[model samples]
Target chain A: MKKRLLYFCKSFKINFDELEIYDKDFIFGVLGVLVEYLSGLLMMFFIYDFVEDINGWSLDQVLFFYGLNLVGYSLWSCFFINTITLPYYIQRGEFDRFLVRPESPLFQIMMDSFDDDSWGELVTGLIILCYSWIRLRIPPIYFLALPIIVVSGCLIYLGISIILSTFSFFTIAQADVANITMEVKEFAKYPLTIYPKVLQIIFTVVFPIGIVAFIPGMVLFRQIPWQLLLVIPLVAIVFFVLSTRVWYLGLKHYGGTGT
Target chain B: MGNEIITVNRLSKQYHVRIITEGNIIKRIFSKKKYKEIDALNDVSFSIQEGQYVGVIGNNGAGKSTLIKLLTGILYPTAGQVSVMGRDPFNDRIKNNRNIGVVFGQKTQLKWDLSPLESYDLLKTIYGIDDETYKENIKKFVGLFEMEDFINNPVRSLSLGQRMKCEIAAAFLHNPSIVFLDEPTIGLDVFSKDSILRFLRSIKEESNVTLILTTHDLEEMNSICDRLIIIDKGRIIEEDTIEHFTERFTCSKSIVFCIEGDIWKDINPIDNEVLIVDNGKVIVSNVRKERVNEIISLMLANNTINDVQIIEPNFTEMVKKRINEGD
Candidate 1:
């Protein structure tokens, strides 16, 4: 694992060095990310202004949920965004290149591409989370639990991505499926109580997008029992293990048919 | 001979492909899932000794790539057993990969956004190559392939020939005992092909790495390979030394003579041996090795010949003939 991390560092450094050669393009990419980040925050503020309270949760609480979602999403994008291209590689028969390498295919895919743009989202998410934490004045215990929640939330999001990426092995037109499932996370930025009951159930159980923010927010608001917070880590582990199994099964079925 | 580096016992691979039927809207909407099983490899078995240069040749869909994939553990076999370096390749893929290198001519394994040198550094960490060995191998390959000019350039910016050179160099950086190249010279220009082939030959002489090359280019096989394995319909039809394989397919030679006059009508044939006369030339084929002098003398005495040439069967022709015979 340590060696794999080192490999990621080495690969990312190389990518950074290459990006450095195109200084203008690098600058544009960074600036574009900042613009998007700012625009997204502005949109969230506008929505909160229109609705002072959503499903009994104040604007500050909703902001905390949004911030937590960004933190989890950004963390996942940092390492796992490259998995979105798994279907393309399979269709092109390029996945065989990974099979011949000594490293795990999952690890190699995670380390193959780095998203520099996600750093902007990450910093913005951190700042918002800190700001909302001070405004809400949650318990000190919640502060201690924040790191664990973030880690668990990242795993859940990554697990969902891996599960969707595994579908590429079965069909070529899986990009839409992944896109729709990812877009569902957008609903998590608000309180789950405001959504329809069916969507709330789907978000809580089937896809579990709420684990990133809604569930953690409920724990912070003391709306749910503290004992239920354990479900976050448990769900993360279960989802991760199941997704990994599906990935391996998909690999076994890969015929490597196309050139 | 050195120890056997690869062994196969009746290996086979079968894939289930979906078959979709064309029909009306209603029928298409309710289309049933239909599958047809196709055998990519069938009971094929062969072994290669360490340090041998072997060439595998077959027509399209003859299981050349399938065999390589099975050996490299990219695809699992439906039946039979394969062992590379005394380990089950599919079951022990991670361990097996540590000692083998593979190159697919149709694909690029290098990171497109990064330079070859940077990619090599990442691979070095993956393979755990020592600092001294990695530096020495990189320097040697860069010098031999003349890649100093573009080694640091992004892979996307390099020409196909330059990228291919870097790809081959990257494969050999770890100095594995076995290397599998599938059409390594495909899409290369004449100059690039010559340089790559020369480098491969030089490596053969300097190292004991076993080379398993699969290509449609019989000229390359003839030039570098010590042994040839011919496959047809997913099975090994012929496996022998280059000399024996060529000898088996070569039955006769042709002799063409440029005749100044129509002298074929004047020459009385011995034992009904016919001479083909066309466009001021006489041609004779299937001449016995010992009868060459007799045939030439008879032609000379009868006709005024301007030029005489003998044509031996080439490797390309032999391969074509072999495939035709199989069909």
Candidate 2:
């Protein structure tokens, strides 16, 4: 694992010292990250200014949920956006190169491009979380638990992206499927308590978006319900394994059209 | 002389694809019925002994690319099997893949934004090549390809030939024993093409590395490949030693001679079989290699020969004529 991590770092960390800031991908990366960060901040400000609290919780709790979502979502965009665009690569015959590499094609595809836009959202989300915790005078343990939530949330999101991207093999037209995935993800941006009990049950047990965001938020607030925290890693692992299996089966059908 | 390093047996590939046609909105809505199955490769089979140089030639969509893809393990065979170096190409182990290098003319493996040196360093780390070996190979290729002028330049800034040279260099950085070059010299200028061909020939001779080249450039095959496999319409039309194939296909020699007298009207060189005839010059009919001396003696005795030019079958013409005949 240590060797694999080092290999990943070597492939991803190109010498930026020689790169101009005006380079198109670099500029686009910055713009993309900034837009997401600012949007999350704006949404936080709106929610805090309007209602004093939502769903039996203070504005600070809501901000915590928002921050948690952004942290996960931003990290997903940072490394895993390639999964969302698998259809385009397949149609254009670019995915064959990934298949030929020694590493897992999913790994290569997930790390193909890092979205700089996610950095802004990640920084802003952290700052908002800290400010809210300081304002609410929450215990230092909440701060200690923050990294755990973010890490688990990021893994869960990564697993979701892989599962969605794997659909491109079966569904020849996959852009609409990706949009549907985004819509499902957007529903989890808020606390689950605000939705109907049926949706809350489905989101918590069936699809588990609530487990990634709201449950982690609840854990931070010391509303720790049962041994659900242990399930986070398990969920991420199960989804990741299943998606990888599907990706492998799909690769068997990969007839690389020559250019 | 040695065991076959690569073996392909009765390989085939089939694909189901949908291509929607432009039409009225109503037709588009209800007529979602446009799917077709294409058999890209049909029961193609061959084997390559270790360190052998082979050239695969065919027209567009004749299954050359399909065969290469199947061999490299990028595409699965609908039937039969392919084994390279005694292991399946699609095996998920890095160890199995480290022995092979592949370069596609249409795709570049180098990072577009990074300098060639930086890309090389990154690849070295990923492939876990030690510092000494990496530096030694980089220095060697840099000298051979005259890449010093642009090694530090970003790949996107380099000319096409320079970039292609870099791609080839990067593939060999790992010192793979076998290399698959698909149309490597395509679109290169004459000088670049000559340099690349020389580099390839030297690599094969010096290192005894196996090379499988696929291209439409018959000149490349004639100069570099000892064995040739011609594919037509998803089937192997012919596979033989390049020498044997050329000799078999090219049975006649064409000689054009400028004569002093009006040879067109005076001499009936085998009836009206003469391909070209003018006022005082004549282009003789194709004579078999066995009858070359007889035709030349007859021509010399009948007329005053000013200048004569002998044309044999060129590789390009032979391939085109063979493909046309097969079709």
Candidate 3:
């Protein structure tokens, strides 16, 4: 356990040093994050200006939904962005380096690089969550449940990213195809009712982005019962485990057929 | 020989490659079911004992990379068994990796943005190398590879030799029992190649680590390797000591002439044995050892010579000739 901890800590240190994101660079990254969040917040406000609510959801509820998305996406992209580069690695046989290393292949791939953009998104997410929490006058029960909610939401996002990127192992495709699937989050950012009926069902059952943070936001808005939140973590676990299993299965295919 | 640290028994790997012969874009896209099976490696077997330095040599697409990948746990064998340190390399990858180091030619294993020191620190953690040992190995490698000047620079910013030295240092930091080098000297300058070969030679006596090198340069075999394992068409053609292999196969001497621009431009095709390389017009003529002076005189009589030397036929050319002669 001690050795594992040592490796984990050192992976992070090496990643940070390699990324070379200095104080100034990090501050600029934060600014970019804020610009994106504010633009998203502005779009929501514009929608609220014309209509009183989106399917009975007020501006505050919309803000909470948006913030939840940013939080989930930040956590997922922070760790799993490198999965998008799977095709490049597989094509060049650079992925073999991960296999020869002592760490698990997935662990090495994720820790190989650090996405500096995520740190700013986390700060922005928390501020929005806190602002919406006070304005909604939500109950204290959610604060205790927030960590669990975030974990499950992040896992769902991470799982989907992995499953989509795993296609690179078999195909000659690159990151663009996997990146297109990420647009499903654009649907999750808004209230489910705001989308077309097909998109609603698809996000709910097919792509399952609805569960990432949007479902829990609905609970706070009283659109769904709190018990539905119980389903989120379970789905996250199953999805995460199955997606991870698929990654290893992809490795099996890659091993059998050299690139 | 000491204990057999690595062994392979009838190991093979098959790849199902998709055949896209149809030129019709729509049909090609739709009818994607065609695949042809190829045996990248077939029924190959070998063993290396402790502290032995072995070189794997072959032409392109002769199952060399497949064998390396299989032994290193990067690829799984389709049939038979491979044991590295008493464990199946693919099945027990993480454990097998603990005692092995790998360096591939022209492959950037170190992170581009990180310095060698930073990369070494990461390896130390990944391999669980003790602090004292890590420091000691780093110092030794720095001295041997002469990487002190560029050790702190980012890998991308360093010269090829500097970067390669760093990569080799990173591989050895953990002091693995065996080190696998795949063309570790390709594209390196003569000075860098000399230094790398010298380092590998010195380390054998001091470290006692098994070395498995896969390469095109047979000349390197003389410098650092003990035995040569020649593979052709996915099979082991020969395995023998350097002396025996040299004595039997190196029958023809090569006269290489570096002549001024387009020296062979108007000259008629003289012999199939002469190979013309582009830059500097390096003309290498493989003939009988007795005809070395004859070839040199012919080359010198026609053009202004930049350099001339008599050398042994390179491994690929020698193997090609030997195969053609049915030897």
- Expressed as tens digits, the lDDT of each residue in A109-216 for candidate 2 is 765666555666677667777777787676786555566667767766666666666667776654546545555656677788899999889766655657776766
In candidate 1, position B56 carries an lDDT of: 97
Which of the two candidates, 1 or 3, achieves a greater TM-score against the reference? 1
Stretches > 4 Å off in candidate 3: A1-5, A18-30, A193-201, A204-207, A223-230, B247-327
Best by lDDT: 1
Which run of 10 residues does model 2 chain A get worst, by summed lDDT?
A: A14-23
For model 2, how does the per-residue alpha-carbon lDDT over B150-256 read when each residue is reduced to its tens digit? 99998999988998899888878888877888898889898888778877877877786888999888978889988898898899988888888888766766888
All candidates' lDDT scores? 0.82, 0.75, 0.79
TM-score of candidate 3 relative to the true fold: 0.84
At residue B227, candidate 3 shows an lDDT of 82
Model 3 agreement with the true structure over B79-133: per-residue lDDT tens digits = 9889999998898989989999999887888988778888888788788899899
Least accurate stretch of 10 residues (summed lDDT) in model 1 chain B?
B265-274
Worst 10 residues of 3 chain A by lDDT: A173-182
Over B111-199, each residue of candidate 1 has an lDDT whose tens digit, in order, gives 88788998898889998889999999988888788999999888999989998898898888889999999999998898888888888
lDDT sort, best first: 1, 3, 2
